[model samples]
Target chain A: MTLVDEIKKRSVHVDAAIDELLPVVRPEELYKASRYLVDSGGKRLRPAVLILAAEATGSELKSVLPAAVAVELVHNFTLIHDDIMDKDELRRGKPAVHMIWGEAGAILAGDTLYSKAFEILSKVENEPARILKCMDVLSKTCTEICEGQWLDMDFEKREKVSKAEYIEMVEKKTSVLYAAAAKIGALLGGASDEIAEALSEYGRFIGIGFQMYDDVLDMVTPEEVLGKVRGSDLMEGKHTLIVIDAFEKGVKLDIFGKGEATQEETDEAVRILTECGSIDYVKDLAISYINEGKAKLDALCDCPEKELLLQIADYMISRNY
Target chain B: MTLVDEIKKRSVHVDAAIDELLPVVRPEELYKASRYLVDSGGKRLRPAVLILAAEATGSELKSVLPAAVAVELVHNFTLIHDDIMDKDELRRGKPAVHMIWGEAGAILAGDTLYSKAFEILSKVENEPARILKCMDVLSKTCTEICEGQWLDMDFEKREKVSKAEYIEMVEKKTSVLYAAAAKIGALLGGASDEIAEALSEYGRFIGIGFQMYDDVLDMVTPEEVLGKVRGSDLMEGKHTLIVIDAFEKGVKLDIFGKGEATQEETDEAVRILTECGSIDYVKDLAISYINEGKAKLDALCDCPEKELLLQIADYMISRNY
Candidate 1:
């Protein structure tokens, strides 16, 4: 079975883990707000991926669930605040946390989550050193996430943000968390340094690929499949690689320059994306990252734990949802 | 010189720490917007107090600067996002960070601060056990702060927030941090468990007193002396201790019913408080807490660290700032 399927096979246990982890922030004022976000359903990808990565390294998967839950909590915590910052109205097909709790509640809940994540980290037994190492990674990754958010906001106003710059932004914003997730799983499983390092690298590349594919999907996916509003990035005036590439390829798009992109403008921007072969450009990048991520996983399947990780890579880069 | 004074004496180093912590969130879009808010000048009270508390417990005063700086960074981080959620406009006689950075940048900066604090916390090198204990205190203290903030925001809509409720709120909001600061200092100094416990009590009681005094000052102090606007809590329609006291006393006011405070009725609400003698009532409460804080430090003067603790109590409850 795939990692998701494997996790699903023990869904009751995984569900209980998530349930246990959530009450830490439940009594606070923003309880409903945060719960709205957390319960706003999804596949719980980060936690699942962490487990799979742990299992892929020839370790007992259940042994790393604490780390798994911590990664998931961290991911959701960021989502709670990021949605507020991004002014996103919906998350996981429901009203966003901030939309329900108001911004203050969302913010407090986010803070609560951050502390609670550390609380969970402190609770991990028999692996004090590994726990501290995971915390260090988490702390630095969060810093990089902040840097990425800052750059993202900066890029909105700038005339041009280089493709390399775009890569750096997403790496910090998206990939570092993935890297931390995998590394933490490996650490918890007592994987060798080389194996842990490889898992981290695999996660990082796949994470970037996932984001690149997401940007492309935002530009092309039907509303029925994407669930989020069509052309939401264009509406936000965000310079995704698709738009940046088109802008570079001599597409005279006034929308990204000085004026705002309206519904019609948003559609045209997406259409231009199609005409300039931007989707292909992004797909190529995604594929290269996927290939790199797969290479890192080459040694894993030789062990019994490899199936879950390989499945994770396939599921991550290929999923349309 | 007292520890606060000593810290100011080393303003260059403190300034450097400030500069370093600031960049962790610089890339955040609203960072520039909130930079003015975050950079608003204030007494670096928390860090200075941390340094003193550390020194008072027999820790090498210099050895705790990283922790001191960490405390301050965490404090600022909380303030940045707090103002945004409260939708309050001014901090430190300037615009609130959200008002400057927009809500998103403000939120992101706060996130960065939360993460960067762990970085600073990780820098303490003397005793691993000490470091872990400090982290434990900090993690719990942070959660307490969040809980307190949660209550503070929740109180706005409730008709009856009791005196005990108010105390509980402040305990979470303010006291825990002070307790942790003193405890962390003692840990670094290798103080006896009894001594550390007592010192923590001293800091906690003092912190509670300080916040009560802050509320009283908000009622009585001139706007300029407070370095911000007068009647801010009233204007914001906060369910403060004074307001709660007045509410519980059944002081007849034009406003009633369990609902969030409104800006329109704030002036009238202040008049009601004055008529009901609530200002004096709250002041007495502040004095009682201050006395309790002093009692916690009664035996400490013999240790040479007692003076540091004593002077801090005076500063906490007596100083205009």
Candidate 2:
């Protein structure tokens, strides 16, 4: 199948897996909280890549579905908790779990999803080794995600952050799990350790590109299309690459903007960022990183799935909406 | 050894184990939040029992300590998350994680402990099977606890709850982990299934007695001693056996003296319970459960450490403060 067709098919498979896998225990708080997050309508991109990557390696058996589904569940679990932490209002164009159910329920719902991820994982019969590996990866990813959040929280209080530091944060926050998605799939298909490592690197690159592009969207998209603030990243004083570059450029240009700008002036500051070509710098950085990611995929020799991996990588960098 | 001395030795052991296990991560959030919970001087009773139970079974080899510590970490994980969900304030004479750090930090901290539990368990180099089984029991126990929380939330919205219904809640909320703890220790020591099952039953009954004693404490200890609520279960209109009996007797006396009291008023109407010997009834009921729990312990024939188990059971019923 073509890359577009592959993603569409994998998306459908993952959606079905989620529908089948989420058991409603009491049909009340546990299930209701789960449904609240599950129905929020995520891209389901991680799981799609999981199943497709597994298939691309060799087999297209139904056995890959559980880990694929678990990835999606893990993704949503992080989102529910992240939304509560970020105090975000809208998810998939509707009220966030916490906003709708209070911080308490949002927390409970996120926890339920966390436990449920294991519940789904523990049930996958074959590939116990792979599942264990995935669990380790997932658990490590969770810890890494927490660390990234701590750094993000700390950024608001600090003055200067380097480009390398920004890359490290995004790699932890975004790329690790994305890397795990493809890596876990390769493990499921009995791929070689070298090949698996390459897939992980591939994910790491795309994850950075994906997050960088998201930052671009924050600055450039219209409010209605974005479903929240345009330049909300700036308003929140997020130390994303664009903002980081803009600040450095601003300093080089004798700009006194170190930190602690008022929220009301966020856009004005972001406007300064665009005027300084800070936005362009961020964009260029994303392209190079994405190209390096594609280069890593190209370096995965003797893998029949290489072309498919390349197509998916191209699509990730180019995606919109 | 006397019960007090046994508890002291076990407390020192588990406390040290917890101390060692917490620093497995370098980032401060995981360790700080862990210390926040552990340093609360929580009596370390659960892990204490786990160690003593393991000792009573045969070996206090270094292997069991991680399992012992893992259970405690799991317990704290549940508490941190549950407190956030329940919006609780003071725990062990200090502000809850959510209260001090806000809901987000508390949630991440709780998740970190869950991760830390596995990390500690993964360190059991002497008996890897025990570690895996311990994790299995813990993961499953956590899942049940989540279900119980859901039911508790559901019961808050319901008008009537039966005694049988309340017992089932106690099983899920309080007893299962105790059961698992004893069974895990025995299994780790290579105890026969029959022995493990019997000890597990011992743990379960003792757990019931422990919770029942707690319920009785709700009636007698007053809020000042507990550092929170005296009759909180009553105030929350929780359908504990105490309030369930109050409902029965209140209905019997047609004591609509207030002409249709709210559940809150009815809960407060436990004064009416005092007049009608309902508190006495509660005390007697708890005593019977303690007796039943002790009887189950007694039925475990031919054990050298039976005295210790029996002593622990006795302590389960009679301890105050």
Candidate 3:
């Protein structure tokens, strides 16, 4: 089957499961604010990867659905809170939760989703020990995400952030969840520790690449397609790989974190970074990581599910948004 | 031991445990923001109750210390977020975390604490099944607290929230954690389901009374004693039981939720609520609930720990802040 078909099929399964799990409750606004983002359209990439990873390891689709839904909920939870902190007004082609519900409502909504993720995880049809391990992975990932966000925010104020530091932040901020998703799926699928670790490493690499591609997309994607401001990373003074590369390549530009920069100025900054070959530099890095990710999957048995995993990584780099 | 001394002793244990559990981490600001409020003084009431409840059920205090610390962490997590939402600048006699770290830092700090709570809980030395069950309760309580917060916020915009509605909100927002704390303590202490439920009921009742007493204390306590804004709740136009009772008694209250009301006007509102016997009425209710809470100890085997549980209930009603 095509990767698109597989993603669509798995997304529907995960979405339905999420809908069933999060019933609307009293004080309807909180739940509504939470469900608002969940109900909105997304690729559901994390859960799809999780389900695919489970399938690749010889597990039935049903076995991993709860964990799959859980990871998606957690992903959205982070998005909601991050949007609030970043003060982004748009998400997934809609007003962000904070925009509609206000920060308090958004905070509570994000928190509810965070708590519900664990509740759902506890209900996964697995032995208690395995479930505990999964919870530990998830909680640790939560801490890393927070740490990454702190670093991301802090780096904005720093004069210089090394490429290694930037990569570490993205790994914690973006990739840890993905790694945990794949690792959790593999673990719950009865894979041995070595196989699970391999899958986790594969996910970690792909996750890092996915984030680098996102950084590139922020500069290159259209506002309408990205569903938010373009060049926001530049405006926010975020130290994306392109920016780091440009700084190393002697591209003198002052538009970094220029919140009030005009569109022309922002465009010029993007142009400078692109002309300096920093954009291509990041693209190459993304490809390298994706390749490394695929190599880690060689530990798994050859299966169609494994092929889909490779295709998903390719799609991560190729997607416009 | 007297309740005060018992509280003091247990507070030291819980505080030390919490300090050990929450080691400082990288990106120092986030962890610092989290620990800032934690290091400030609190009565450690929840943890004390948890320890007392566990001891009452024949469990060693050490066995339940992690769960006790988890509850306190959860409590602090809610306070950090709620302060941001409420826009309060002070907490526990210090500038609220948002004041020091900015809203973004406070949000991440709270998220870190929240995730850390579950991490700590997952480490409880118990059978996996029991640990899972404890997690289930804690997660559910987290949801209820969110719901309760939503209701509290919703009630502010409301013209008249009935006494029953007020009770239910407090039950969700305040009592649920206490209930979880006690239930967790009982379960980890090897108490039977019946005994756990009894202690949970005890905590729930006391939690409700504790909040009601807090409402009264807000009106009567001086700012220095309360360690924050006194009459802040009234200023927020929250419908505490006293306010609700006065409204029911046909006492016109212009000071309720008077955000811009002068201190004199606020005092006048409090005076009216007090004159209408609403203050006494709520006080009676608080005492009754505390009594009811103590009755739950009837299910426990007689011991010094159980006697301490009874004293703690009385202290909840008698304390100023």
Candidate 4:
């Protein structure tokens, strides 16, 4: 079976687990808002990747279900809050949590999911030391993600943001959770420190590549597929890697950060970005990171699961959006 | 020392510890907004309660400093987000974080502080089992706090909320953190489970009484003292125990939830509440809870710290605001 089909088969289990675990609380709107995006559905990629990582280490997949659900909840928590912060009106082709439930509802929903993630993580049925270690890893990653988010917002206001700064932000905001997921998966699967570290590095590089491809998709993907405005980041003057690279090449885009830009102006901006080869430059960087991610998997035993992990990395750079 | 003086002395240590641990992140606004309420200052009651609880169990105060700081940070985080959700303009005599930093900034600042609190909690120098236990207690409390906040917000839209329902909401929203702080401090300080549970009960009861007193203060305190609009809860139609009791007493409040009511009308509403004996009824209940809280201290050994914890319970009911 193809990697996508394998992922789909595994995601069915992950989705069912999450559905059962999603909080059922009084004052139903809070739980409803929290579950909204989860129900609307996406690839469930984080949990799928996690289960695959655990299985690759020759461990039982069922034992790692709680951690898998916990990571995905954290991911969704970030998305709910990020949408509110970005003031985006749609997610997964439905009204964003904030747009539907209002900002206060969205904030509470996100917070509930966040705290629930840790609560769920605490129940992972591990040794006390390992449980504490997992909590520490997840907590530190959470801190980094929040800091990275602040930097993303901070970048929008600043005149210059280096590629290094952009990469660090993406690593913190986008990649650290993935890194932790793989590391924690290995740890839960009883892998040695060396193997866990290798898997973590793989996830980290792949995460960065996934985000780079996301940056490219923002410029190239249509609004219908993307679920919101195609170039909302550019309109917000976010110094994504593409924007930073374009500025370095002396290719100034008219619509960068201009909230009032017309569709024609945004199209022109995308056209300029494409002509200046910034999009291709970002795609190349994404490919390189995916390659680096796949290389880390060489430490694991040669198995079908390991091959799937490699295919997953390639899929990161190759996806349309 | 007088109970107030003891609290003052303990608060100095808590404040200083917090000052040192507060995140000094880039995008200075997030940190600034977070520290804003902390810097402007009020009673560091939560951490002091934690330390007092530890001391009551004959535990070293120094060892639980990280836990103390963690609880305080979580308190401030709730304040930041709660202010935004409530749309209150002032906190601790300064513009609320959202007013100064914008909602997005405030949300991020609150989130940064929330994540930072757990990060700090993980650093507590305790046995792995104890630390993990603390994390579990803290995580569960965090979840309750979010749920309670949602309920508080939800209560604003609904009529006929019961006193029992209001108590549960306050327990989750206001008291659980206090309960967790005391319990975790006891565990960290090497107290037995029985002692920790007793201390947690004490904190929980005191927390309820404290909120009851706060509800009373909203009517009696002037704006300068409360650092918010007087009767803001009433203006928002929050069915505090006072409101519920007033209704039971056949005292219909003309200014209740009338956001446009003149100051004279609100003052008249307060006068009627006082005249109908509803405020006094709520005050009696607050004192009862405080008395019950003090009773929990009977389980601990006789010591000055235990005496002080009893005095602290009394102080909770007697505070002006």
Q: Give the chain B TM-score for each candidate.
A: 0.87, 0.88, 0.97, 0.97
Best of the two (3, 4) by TM-score = 3
TM-score of 1: 0.90
Error of 1 at B286 (Å): 1.9
Task: Return the TM-scores of chain A for each candidate in numbered order.
Answer: 0.92, 0.90, 0.97, 0.97
Interface DockQ of each model? 0.56, 0.37, 0.85, 0.75
How well does each candidate reproduce the native contacts, as fnat?
0.64, 0.28, 0.84, 0.73
Question: Which of the numbered candidates is closest to the native, going by highest TM-score?
Answer: 3
A261-295 per-residue lDDT for model 3 (tens digits): 78788788888888889999999999999999989
Mind giving the per-residue lDDT tens digits that candidate 4 earns over A1-321? 888899988888778877777756676778888888877878877787788888988676777788888899899999999999888788877889998889999999999988888888888877777777778888888878888898888887799999999999999999998898888888887788899899999999999999999999888888888876888889888999999999999987787888757788888998899999999999999999999999999889998888888888888977876
lDDT of each: 0.74, 0.71, 0.89, 0.87
Candidate 2 — which pairs collide?
Answer: none
> Residue A279 error for model 4, in Å?
0.9
lDDT of 4 by residue, B1-321 (tens): 788799888888877777777756665776787788777777888888888888877666777888998898899999999999999888887888999889988998888888878888888888999898888899889989998999898888887888999999999999998899889988887889998899899889999999999999999999887787789888888999999999877788887888756789889999999999999999999999999888988888898888888887888877776
Model 4 scores a C-alpha lDDT of: 0.87
Off by over 4 Å in 4: A260-267, B260-263
Per-residue error (Å), model 4, residue A313: 1.1
Model 4 pairs whose backbones collide: none
